[model samples]
Target chain A: MVTPLEIIRKKRAEAVNRIVSKGYLSTIRVYVGMATCEIAAGSKEVMEVFRQAIANGLTDVYLSQKGCAGRCNLEPTVEVIEEGKIPVKYGRVTPEKAREIVERHLKKGEVITEWAI
Target chain B: MEDVQYKMMLCDGVSCIHNQSKELQSAIESELDKSGIRDAVSIHLSGCLGMCNKGPILIVNPGYTIYGGVGSEDVPEIVQSHLVEGKPVARLVIEEDHLYNRFFRIFGDVDFFGKQMRITLRNCGVIDPENIDDYLSVRGYEALAKVLCDMTPEQVVAEVKKSGLRGRGGAGFPTGLKWGFTAAQKADEKYVICNADEGDPGAFMDRSAIEGDPHTVIEGIIIGGYAVGATKGIVYIRAEYPLAIKRLEKAIEDAREHGFLGKDILGTDFSFDVEIRLGAGAFVCGEETALIHSIEGARGMPRPRPPYPSVSGLFGKPTLINNVETWANIPVIILDGGEWLSSIGTETSKGTKVFALAGKVHNTGLVEVPMGTTLREIVYDIGGGIPNGKKFKAVQTGGPSGGCLPEEYLDTQIDYESLAKAGSIMGSGGMIVIDEESCMVSLARFFIEFTQDESCGKCTPCREGTKRMLEILTRIVEGKGKAGDIEKLERLGSMIKKSSLCGLGQSAPNPVLSTIKNFREEYEEHIEQKKCRAGQCVALLSYVVNDECVGCGACKRICPTGAIEGTRKEKHLILDEKCIRCGQCYDVCKFEAINKV
Candidate 1:
């Protein structure tokens, strides 16, 4: 019979496995602000553009949607989390700009200095 | 093998979800899949990280780096460089200095969380609330296990007493004393209840707590039950909080399955179970007696407080009822010890208090601070001061039943006694920072109207008295106030305070009374001069075309009434006879030509 301590250990291990299996240990992550304010600021369209770019065979990218980033005035904000490097936050991104970000920043390892928040 | 080396937590709280966090989450998952490193990374949809205005917020583990204002297009680059190349992204990091300076100015450059002492909110933004394993890993049920295995019911109550926890539901009643009162009663069947019917406008502290960490509240409730010698626990949550309800129900089921709740919990003889009761969103039900009635399937109304829910409550038996935040503090008190918890806050009030900072503040969000923290620190340091550089006016605390304190009271310490002495109650921790632009008369009218509507009419003083007060306040704001209106309001206010049946009636006059006490000059100006200095009362305002008028016909063209007249390229004039005082001309004019005085 499994003791309570054993159950707790099992649960912890399972949780860790679940997180590890889902690629949380991956080196980089991209977060898109999709809060209501961001959506009103056309983050949905920007997200679609990114999806289309990835569908067009963009490789090695981990894209996820996040909630409001606090600054309502700077909606449609994008955050890039790359391992061993400082994360970059880009603001006021449009769909066309989204495509440009994928090609110039994601593909070429270049930071878009102008759009950073 | 440590298969995962990094963790990404995305804020999925109400505000974040409103900002399209779901779309952001899906985008991240697809990017991870595309990167072919899905097995190495984990994405957690967590609760509010408090920096609401800076969403959608993303926190990366290993270094605890937070990135704000993220977008979908930035996903691929983040994965390729950070995950594959083992290099952290420099530009995406939420600037440590900026975040620290923005929210923690009171504590000075400590980061957004530096000023906050998060006791009840310990697990909220840090963990995925829906997952039971996540809760267990955080030592969630350890308190319940300890209470059942080691501490006697009296001993548990004594520890809580030593902690000096007061109800976060607004009354500031000593929680330990309430538990003792209920435990001392001899009864066959007793119940411990969690009051989650958070009905205060602009107050989301309880909702956020439940959403961020449902298991913590459940754990607290189980401990309360053990202390009070109750076998059954009930959480009386409002139906409007569907997300919190969903998570809490899931947590209860998981706890039962894990032997933390139900029949012989943790293999001990002490057994306890919990159930959920939905309140139909009545503000009055937040009161303990009304909540008890609602749980019993009655008309959610409050009777006199002789029995006080401790002696006779919910099916007419001994019961213990605490607010959502009060329950959330339980596990922490057990883990940290009563003395440790007591040492943090003021002498009278112990532990931290969670406040939902709203209104015209720069950094409007949820903040938890120690009890002795002054209102000045909260407004300026943590809330980032009033927005648009407006002069800080009065701040409203304790919902409609609480009073509004003027600028002079800004340094007042935020505890029950201190706030009461300052003419405002600490309430349920809804701190609305009023700006110079807000009219005190109108503000008083708003609270009176709210209390009048929510009054159950059980008592004559609250039901009819509030309506009469609202009429006088309405007349005063409408530029038709008489000399004796203020006196009449004061008289009625004091009468209601003395004669009211429940807490709702007793505190109904607080807003009107406090506003008059603090900003009496504004009231006098509204009555005697027929002018609202803030220009909020439209009835007392007049529109005029100023010297700066460039008359591009913008104001003339948009004016619903043809009050603005003048040819193109010339200064416009407002015809006083025809002007409706709608302020449309003021809004439409590109130049600073139109003025409302």
Candidate 2:
């Protein structure tokens, strides 16, 4: 006999739990722009390169795809997020640059200042 | 176990998806896993964030720091510096100051979103739209619960009336008054209809609202049902908006499961249910009478309306129809009180109005601002002015039915009365900024064509008058203007406005009349001088070789009709008789050789 109040409370608690488990508060997230403009700008190849690199070695990261980043001219946009840090956005990335980022930045923990948007 | 410390929101709206936001998401996840910080962060894929031009946008919580134009390769650096180390990557950060100052010459001292007061769009891009729990967490459905438990039907109506909310579906009918009318009607069977048939071109406020927070609309509709003593609500959304429909369907299902909708809503005696009916993409179906007719399994046509929808609607019973944006505003008005809302906007028009700022502007997207916010602020400040430094010419507000306003009227405050005073109605929030490049005559012709095509043809004035007006406007744009064409158009336009049965017919001639009134010079240039200053009227333009031509022979080689005849490194001659006006040579010319005169 769950009341409506209890159901709402339960839903709220579940939302909090979902948020935590999905890495809203604790996980580093990488968002790749996969909109038509970005696809036209060779984002598909860049995304493929990132996926292959992740499968080869990357860990503790949550990688996902998203829609366009408004700057059409600067397509193939990506944003990275981690707890207690400022999110970094990079634009106009190629497949080779994506691999180099995975090796130097993700693995060795160095910010690639030149590639950052 | 360590507690989560940060939240990251990635915009996954229509435009953002086009920019490869999906790849960016996976790359971030991979980086976080590598850094072993997966347990300390949360990521949300959200809807449009208004600044769609700067997608795929990422917002980090705690500071609301936004990063735009990000790519997969940059994900590693973000993980390294920001995820592992405590410092934010400076270069990638989208500075608030920069967004405000980028077009300082145009906007002067005002910020992009300085005048914007987001009420209906408060939860957009802030929550995951698909997740019901996320919506519930943000005090969603609390208004419905409050309405059901604490207030009576008359009381709810009074509060709404006090809020001074008007219909957002083009005509600014008082929402509270409309509800009161339906409530006063003694009908056993009553219905609440949400007019989600957004048929206006380039307007997407309602679609974005539904996609961003579906639960809000659901809550608002349910509350309206309660207020009007109605047992059933129907969302009349167009089939064209597949994403909004999907999200709304999910939201409705979730609400029913959670006891917010269906029988005995939120532990109260008030029982109401909502269902969706898809419109077959007819622009005329947006009108109340036509919509009611369509809902009744008849042809989508407008009938005479003295016994309005409130008296005799939806199967000969009283029906209350409100726009999607109007319904979306209900929950907030109920929760925050009408006095709070009424205080925000102008004296006449209260609360925020959502405008789809589009066409030839820098920041082309959705913006929700208070009623009194000037067009100057909307175009220059929020929209970042005309793109590529083009001179501002005119702005068309209120869709095809609305009028075009010239540059001098930019300072006019936006409200129902103010817009009406400027010869344009505060339509369903489609504001298209026209630059110097767009010919006013061609623009008027384009809108008249749309209205003419969309007219339901049931009434003689709308169907026949619009057709006649379209013919005259078309001929003018095609360089076949007559002496009395403008006067004939004005006569036909006023006749349509007076004699038309429905709103579609009455407002059909607005684009033509308004453009002629505002940009008469452009129209005269086309008619008298036999030229289009904007070069948009193809019939009025002639291709010629200019003095700037370096005689590269590129135009001669590229001309499909072989109109250009010249020796190598010599001035080209265009045989006007043989020219097809394809403009292929114009595009291929390297030395600015080709000109359209």
Candidate 3:
């Protein structure tokens, strides 16, 4: 339904505006060690939990992923970084823990001290 | 303040963490409170010191003494001896451990640090990945400073050429050669690009590098920019990798703030900066040409290229693109100089390669081995051999685009040329170990299915040929294969490899080709007798209870459908009609009771 001229204009706008305007830069980062060791350690659910949480507006966070930390046994591991603090690496974060992390850490920044990293 | 000297750096690395590490932490805190020496010492939980076996560990700083297997009971002794008397605890101390001695007594010899070269894994377990200071403290930006201050663009290219380093992003193309090609162009604006779109199955070396140590890649790209006369760098990472992207973004910001990335970098006349572009998870977008198009906001499909990215790329600017691992090596090569870097690995490869060693391998994680290291050493010695004591079959090195090498080639030194010589490519170093019980046809189908799902579908040969090949392999695995199916698969595979425009299409047939070549008997049994030798292909399988079965009703209860039929306290039989072949019953039988024929 779009014309070639409109598409070209859209492309031009994309190029020029990306430089001029800073986009929604709030980093909603999530980490899942999907390496073989992490997979064996069950990181897939950790990712799913993040996905579901993000879908639910639990926290406006970046859902990111990483490979193994070379420490493969801590499967379903996650690391969260916000405004001020060292990034917290939370290991074996299950769906339940993930939910709690979203509610406690992501929303309030009161780091769920026990599950924070 | 009483004293802030009772420091404890606990090892919360995966190995220790699993062994009730949190409990150990609580115990230390509680014990410290009881002794009233908590104020004298502090606790900092660090990462894996790499001796993963005996952990739940702690290393007290200042003296940098190490302790292993210290449970809740040992904290009191630790505080009294180290915090109070400032003397080493003899019972809990790790004296014989070479790593501890060097770490505490002397300064060097990073334990578990013998005989291994780290280029890709340079920052792992050493520097806190999230901290730019940790990276800076370890001489991170010195290469950037040297490249800008000392070396000319031509000289940088020459040094890389002399080092003989090649791309670790699968194809093993000579890095210097690619740089020189991009450098040869006299464009007004040039770009340094990093391909972080790692989509290979069971491959995660790139992800680890980016996540664990992202600054290395950024520094490498900045140096690459200096070499190629590029003012801009773009890291084309997959959108699927939120961690790599996040780390990369942080690194870019950090570099800019530190005068390592933005204009007049480190007070030099040179000006360079980087931006990030995200890929929508197409495997083909990993190709340099396709990556260029994607960065330009075009369709992420590759076009025929004589004007390669070196000649025309990213809105037709001259570009130099290297994978994350390739970029990681540049900083090391630059700082050490070419000859020192060239000392390791085979003559052709000239460095270490990081692999995501998975499947039947015991230590299934990231391993970095020098190029030309035999598959035998990587799979057996370093990887702790195969699990369950199964006979080794073949390793699918690279990804779908790489060939499978059999046990006969275990001694073959790992390098681009050597792997290719053995009919397999050294690909992106996804070394997936296969055991005796794996069916070759099913394996091929698995990879083909993966590629097919990921195909961008821009080219005819790739789109159609991959689909056809996948269908054939699927048929063979499901026991619906005909006599000439193998021949058809070969023909289609060869055509796809030859005619496909990009690397993805070209190497798409490698799985089918290599499996057929190495495990021909496996394929033959599947085709000729309509039986799967490995019992992996579900359609060619039927579940039956053998003498090993005891009724117990566990299998019956677990079955989603009423697939199992049996009397109480007796052996259960698999009912063919009612059995949905879900294999739920097979999983529940305690003994090796259920047999699939």
Candidate 4:
């Protein structure tokens, strides 16, 4: 029988491997601050915008919700991190701005300096 | 795996769920279907972020843009503008102020999390709490595995002892010593209990901890059971916390399936199983002995402790009981060496404390600060000071059993010894900030009322003594106080403190005693002058027509009693005999005519 230690080790290894193999380093990553406060601030709608963009054939962009980014007033926050690049955060996001981000920033490979927090 | 182009994550925390995050998820799914690219994106749910005030947050990758307060109605617009156009939404972006932007420049963006050190709350908002895989990725059960494989039970006990970890549940008893006593006992069966009966008003630390990371608490309890040679573990939580209980139940089920619980756990001779016991919401049940009694299906009254629970507990056998916060610390201490934790806190109290910061404060939420961090930092720097720029009067710590500290104590460091020296015990991290608008006498009366109602009536000193004290406090606040009422309260409060049974009765008078010690002048003013300086006591306030009275008939029309006698557009005279002191005239006076004297 596999020891409980071995079982735990195997599980932990698999979990970590899954996270790594998901292309965090290679893929473009997007993080949403979806703490309860952010969600109340309409981050869910902002995340939906990203989902729609991806469904429209936006590729290699990995999107995930993180806990609060700590700036509560800037809820419904969105962040983008590319390989070997500094992450940029946007605060007080509306659905319209989310769509604009998909067009101007995500597709054109340009940072929206005016919108970035 | 399919070459997924974009990933979107939604919050599955209880708060988001309440905000219809599920509906929002489905709405996005259908929106993707409408675009005929459903397989291009994937959606997943994660745990609560500390920003509970914001909910239903969503994240999209590639640009790492976060959207807050997203509603279902706005879904189609997001899809059309962002997805079809290949442009991330600019309109929906959250914009913070310049100070936060500077912090982003100076410290890489600390924001609301700048002053916080998240040791206990590490995994809370980071992972999908319900998914065991999410927990596993964060090395969730690593500590237990280490304890089972490498360290002996005695070594585990010794490690905890070296950490200088006092119990987070009020009285700062050394946790390791309690475990050692139970371990040394030659009983055939020993039990470990996690106390979740958090009865302090406005406290949600334990509830949030359980909801965000139930597995941690379970892992801690299991490790505790292993270290103390106990085969059974019980989590005694109040039934009021339904969500926490549900999450904890799910976590236990998952752990058992993973072989973290049950016979020969982790392929060792050590076998343990955990069960949940629901408390009936008694404040006294937070006491260890009373908690043990409640677990045993008894009336939940605390007994005298020459035979502490460590020596003689459940079923007449030795038992180890630690509060929810205390147990939450065990796994961390085991994983990170005791020295690592000891280095972070004060010499006497090691590790950070989680406080539910509420009342009259700007940022009212849960905050965890390292031991020896000043109250000033917590109240001003973290809590953003008193709301509306009101002068902070006093802060109440440690629930009703704890004392209230005055403004002078703001610089005082938060720890077991420092707080006690300031005439307050750190009772389970309930920090309520009081403002100048609040009356101190009324505040003391409010706490006494709560404690007196929840006294459990088990002992005389607590039952009768608290009743008498409450009566005196009530009279004083109601403008009927006599000259000797303050002395009567002090005498009764000290007597109850010295003679009560259990912690509930023993410290029941702390609010009265501490308020008297710090704000005696307020009490004297209430009694001697028959006046409430803060104007909080209605009975003591009498509205008088001042020189500015325009006799607009507003006071006359609004007063329930015909207390104001004057013609229109002239100064009104408020009759003292007929005036009920309702303060209707005071509120209705547009001319600043009626003054509450």
Candidate 5:
């Protein structure tokens, strides 16, 4: 019989594997800077923009909120990471740009150079 | 159609809530519904991002764009423009320097976080604190598992001791040694208490730690319990921190469900459980003895030490008490080993310290730096210097119990020994940067007043001494002080420091004493010349109409007291007797006519 300790060890292993595998499986990832400062600076609207885009059938893209990267003045930051590609960080993202990023960048596989910080 | 392609994590920290982040969340939900994409995206709540000033933060995945300062009014535009049209809003994007590129480079090379080394705050702001899975994925509870499975109790204590970890709760006591003392005690029941009663004015390090990553603190506490052979743990936190309390409560519940906190954890016989005890917001209760008293359902008053809490404490049993920050350091020590931590900080003090950077600094937020990092680096490089181009006057450290250091002391490395040698205790890390506009004499008086009011009055020296010092400082600020008032204050301050029963009274006069030592001339000017150069003391200020005044009659018209008497387009003259010294005329003077002397 497996003891409680062994059960927990197994659970931990399973969690690590699940998280690591998820990171690898996703073809493209979108990260929003969702720190308190970023929220105060209007990142929520940006998130909604992305949500709507995804609902419009944006596929193969996994989106999540990450913690503050400490660049507070340029908050509401956004970054797009594609597998085997350099991640692109976009600062001061608004709702309108969120749609453009989804259509122009995520769909066409192009970085929004003018807006990327 | 397919799985949700976008996930947005919204900050649920107290600061964000205060900024109406919940309203923002609902607004986003409604907007998503309007755009008909509610099913394609998901929104999850996360912890603090450390940028409290800019709250209600949101991050979107797959092209990580962090939008800050979001409001409800801006929601529809975001959905219509970005989500529907496939174009991001240009006006709302937070434009930052292109120096930083990584999304989760919390320890990145940016100016605000460049100098910071986040060890105690490792997972803070990064993980969804309420979710145990997020914490577990980041190597949480693994240290506890390692301690319970591989290392014996003695070995655990030895590793902590070897790490050279000291208490982060003001006093730099060895944490491992304290555990050793408790382990040696002969008792059927032993207790370990996490002292979360962080009472320092402007200090929120403990609150943020618990709010951002409660599991880390919980994990540290459990490891501590295993090391000291304690089966019971209590978190004595202040009731003022409702969000922190709620998060900690949830974290405890989650940890228990996951079998990390309950009996026979990880299939070992070392069963440990933790309970939460709320403090009624007493500053003195931060003292270990007083904290234990409060936890025992008694009045929160500190008793004299001899039989320290490690020997006999909490209902006549050996108890181990560590501060919130101290306990938060445990898992890192266990996971990284003592030698690894020992290599980071100064020669004596190992690892990093978290400071609540407030006051005149441009970036007034939480910053953690390795021990021995200079005050200049903290105040300038990391804090972005004093705001509005104001001259850096001084930085106050250690809160009310700590002292204010002058610009000359900027090079002094921040460590236990150096801070104490500078006549300031390394308090629970409340660093307030002072600008040139603030008068040191008034600042000293403000701190002394707080201590005098909070003085438990249990001891005579702290009670009577702080009251008298405050009175003298008050008199000095009001321009009623005599020649010998400063000296009298010094004598009383030192006496109180020596005779106080607890840490409160002993360190109560620290602000006054340190200000006197560094800015003695400010006090001398206040007493002798009856002049406050910073013009902070209203009673000592006298407004005069100077030649620079252009008879604009703006000052005369705007002066509530009608103290200024002048014609249009001419220099104004202030009636000194009628002037209440409100500085209204000075502010209204367009031609720089009003002079404050």
Candidate 6:
């Protein structure tokens, strides 16, 4: 039986050999806004829904968080990005709605027109 | 290199957190499973995205669509329609006229973001803080790289000096002059400090910066260290801000790994590192001298300044200290020439200011307005013009250390010099909007109460004088104020402001002074008429069941001492002696009964 640590080390070595770029990582990014304005308007839960969705599936998405956009009053903001698109910005998504985003928007390319601005 | 694919992001700041965001995570997971395309989509939770008045935010990447005021129930609909169909969520979209979109509608067109330049907050909400690559993509450490690879220490200091950029952490000291003072000294291990211990009662500009763009501060510090030829830097943040601390720690690790920090950063001779020191939540630590003392493993108390921090700072060496916001600005100033940076704002005050615009405003949140924006624009256009259509009475700037600008001063340009001219100091950019329902006397007393408690017993003027001022304020709020107390407050305030040991004590009297300057009539009414005009001060209030009472038992049930004696559906009578005047009963009453006059 192989030890998990050794296996992880071996896999890491393999990953390094396979690495195309130095000190590089394949990143899938998720951004949650938790500024004071967002809190008052309740964006915390909206971010959490996505977190749970990702944690359950165990996808390799890198999480980056931030503060208010100076818009204040409208909160529970999240932005997702890949290598392009200059950041896909979104605002005011709720928890249950977060599930819809994951299922329909994330899993499928179809975005809920009612929710998308 | 492969182009970026797809993403789904959500808001998870205070506004979203309160709305049970925890449950939404599971829902998203389960929903994605049903679609069998979860592999293609990635979901992430992030901090506040602002414009929280309409919240529970979400943004879908690749198409750049925003949905506002969302709920858990709307999840399936979004997935089935927009997510599956690739359509816009129009119903949830905030369709404001041509502006910065739904995200910054309240602030973008308003003076809060329009009048302000965005040097310090350039990448705040636009970029992701956790990803070094995102920061890199946005030219994050390019400034640091430039400083290390090209400019000499003298050149760096000279450029900064040419910009005429002053410290945003009060006292308005030029950044270049301070850097020069530190650079002139020959210390083997000089230090660069970012004073992130923002202890102002309602001020959270520093907190927002750290939480929003942690790398900017890191880049700023690295640049500052490179400019001053310092090998080390320290960020003194308060323990109360866990999010900021967490992000900053991550930023440090990332910078070190990315060759922006640690030994031979970017394979250059320049080597700099940063550490986080959490202050024990003392308001006085906002003062530079006290902050240095705190960083030196001592109690945060200000010592009289003769040998300033620039000469003999942390650990008995020349140190350069600037606030988080000030540090946040360095990268932009360095990247964009000093001339471009100097062009914005007034001659004295350059760059945009980030303000925690709170209280009585419709779109209350963190705002980055230009230096020369008027109070009217920030309050009206950006703030959504006060909740429930209330008239704007005043907007208080500078936190406890600032003065309240009255309605007459609405059009006054908000720069350090202009604010000071209007009897307020730009103290850390805590702009609190006050409406008609707010009592000036109580407001003044509230700030005095905060200052009195947070005062370190280092200086007699701040310690004893604040206590005296608090007492006098308490009296006025209780409607027990004497005629002569106003004169005494003025005299004492002048003395405290003029004679205090440091910035804390000197500016501690600002709330009292500014409120008095603007609303002296409120104090006079409290003294002469023995009334609390806003009906806030309980001591001056007397509960009486008025004719408008429809026999609602809310007041009776809510009264702490059973002060109200009434049957169901009958007018109540307050037993005044039994009433502790908690005012809970007054707020609970739905009818026009329970008069507090």
Model 1 bad stretches (over 4 Å): A1-10, A28-117, B1-111, B566-571, B575-578
- Cα-based TM-score, every candidate: 0.78, 0.79, 0.72, 0.76, 0.79, 0.77
Model 2 chain B lDDT-worst window of ten: B100-109
Tens-digit per-residue lDDT, B60-114, candidate 3: 7556577888887787787777777777787887743321122222112212122
In model 2, where do residues sit more than 4 Å from their true spots?
A: A1-7, A27-117, B1-114
Model 6, B67-90: lDDT tens digits are 777778877777667667767667
| Steric overlap count per candidate | 76, 78, 14, 72, 68, 75
Ten residues in sequence with the least summed lDDT for candidate 1 chain B: B100-109
Q: List runs of model 5 lying over 4 Å from the truth.
A: A1-9, A16-117, B1-109
CA error at residue B585 for candidate 6, angstroms: 3.9
Number of the predicted model whose TM-score against the real structure is largest? 2
Q: What is the TM-score of chain A alone in each candidate?
A: 0.82, 0.77, 0.69, 0.86, 0.83, 0.64
Residue A29, candidate 5: how far off, in angstroms?
A: 5.2
For candidate 3, the C-alpha RMSD (Å) to the true structure equals: 12.3
Model 4, DockQ value?
0.13
Q: Write the per-residue lDDT of candidate 2 for residues B1-597, one digit (tens) a residue.
A: 123456667766556789898999999998899889998876766444445567788866545667888889888887787757756778889854321112111111113333455678766644557777667767777677667657889999999999999999979999999999999999899999999999889787787778767788888888888888889999999998776788789889988998888888767667889999999999999999899888988999988888989998999999999998999889888877787677667789988899988898987766877787789988887787888989999889999999999988999999999999998989999999999899988888888899899998888998999999989988998899988888898999999999999999999999999988988888888889898999888888889998888788888888888888988777889999888888888898877868899
Order the numbered candidates by TM-score, best leading. Answer: 2, 5, 1, 6, 4, 3
Per-residue lDDT for A1-117 in model 4, tens only? Answer: 666568788989887777667645545777765555567789899999999998999988877665543444456778876753445677778999999988988888777777765
Candidate 4 residue lDDT tens string, B284-342: 89999988888888898889987988899988889998888888788778877776677
- What CAPRI class is candidate 2? incorrect
Is model 3 an incorrect, acceptable, medium or high docking prediction?
Answer: incorrect
Overall local distance difference test of candidate 4: 0.79
Q: What lDDT does candidate 2 reach at residue B352?
A: 81
